[model samples]
Target: MSSKRMATIMGVTYGIAAIMPFFVGDIRFIMHILIMCLIWAVVASCWDLIMGFAGIFSFGQVAFFVIGAYTSAILSVQWNVPSVVAILLAGVFTAGMGVIVGLPCLKLAGPYVALVTFGVHMTLMPVLRGEIGIALGSGGSQGILTIPPVNILGYTFSSANQIPTFYFTLFLSVVCTVIILAVIKSYWGTAFLALKDSEEFAMSLGVSAFKYKLMVFALTSFLTGVMGAFYGHYIGMLSTRMLELDLFCTLMVMLVVGGIGRFPGAILGAFITVTANELLAPLGAYRAVTLGALVVLLVLLLPNGVMGLWLKRSDAEA
Candidate 1:
């Protein structure tokens, strides 16, 4: 399929998804699920940008996410900053940290970089727990509660109505998706792909691995931070547990399950995984085991992920 045609189809599909809540009536639970899916979809997409596209195995993605949430929460609750401002500032702060973290780690290659990132991810909880300053307002284990919802243009997203929150998150997800797709289609994206395929070859061709790696690292971190801030405020609380390795693993699962390098794979992965998780909630202890088995089976059966299967079928038909 041509790029133009593929883009048109994706646009229409996302358009339908954006308007889906309106037709679903008053099913708040479904809307909530959809919102969560979109949030994770954005995070997964950001992950795909750095790991899948740039070939940077960054396990510290969740750390930037946690930083964004905490920054937004603290700014809004302690300093009376606006929701929009807080989220943007959170993105900025997280991006700055991404630079700080990426500078040292990006110099390393392969598993070394991954090890550094994993260490960073593991340190977030300990650091947050140790923060005892009154101005910082550490949530500790109890977490920060009563967080104000996102207020945009005098309209507040209260918990009483999930529809607005749903639409707001949906809009953000769509915007982020478009941005990521645009990046993937740009010259820098070509460089990223080249680097991913062969860092040595790309460097030989004048594509600076250092520059591209840091650029993508900071850019994806910014997106993750923005999503994290929205999540913190929309959910009306912030918890250090949300930054744990489990969430990072889930994001990875979504990316791999959907088709890591494909643009639509992130959304598909998050939707399928999150919906399955919710549906399997009644399974109790077996839920984790079942989900793990499913992931292992999918990885073994469909090595390239769901989108890979679709592509293969399309090619076969052609």
Candidate 2:
């Protein structure tokens, strides 16, 4: 099929898959997977906006993710604010943090920026644990529990009702992804791609590389924070563990295996990785081994990842 037609087909298939849990006997299990995947899809796609288009390799994306969840949770619990308003405030606060971090690190690039961000993520973990953060921030290492479920539009969601949460998450993920994709295809996206190729060159062309880089950083932060809030509400808890280095590594692997720089690759990577993890659950000790082996094989044999290989072959034919 032509690429456009293929994409339409895939989109429909995914939409159906998102709602399948409600009809299937294992509604809870399926909903868990779909909702988790949708959340990762949002955060990972947001990460791609910087890593793929802006060429900013930030290891601390999770810092924003955790901030969103913890911030919303604390605000709701401590201030007795509604969850809806808390979520919005979480995004705003996280985006501000992104800009604060971006300002100094904006002049840095590549591995250097990556290292700095990694440090930032690490530093936040302890604070969230309440050793430095508000005892309310992370509940003093016990983490936030009893977080209010998302309630809006006359709809109420709790942990027991998984299907509704899954659909809600899926809708938000789709919306965020579409917005990011639209930006990438617009003048701003062109400028971002140019900056990715060469910051000096993009600036030479009067692209205001600095301004666009900051914009991408803040936008990414907002999206990532929103996903984090969804995760916190769905899981009914928020902890530093949710934003650990291992999780970031998993995200990196997914992005790499799915093909960095391709939007669909982010979603594809999340699905494959999540599915593989779930399927391998029965193998116990062998699960980690098998996953590592598969990743190694995929990297060694298909270095550009699945989507990258397809694009390369298509280019060769044309």
TM-score of each: 0.93, 0.92
**Candidate number of the best TM-score:** 1
Candidate 2 residue-wise lDDT, 233-263, digit = tens: 7677876786666688778877877767766
What residue runs in model 1 are displaced by over 4 Å at the alpha carbon?
5-9, 132-135, 312-318
- lDDT against the true structure, per candidate, is 0.83, 0.78
Model 2 TM-score, all chains together: 0.92
Task: Score residue 63 of candidate 1 by CA lDDT.
Answer: 85
Q: Candidate 2 — which residues are off by over 4 angstroms?
A: 1-13, 22-25, 312-318
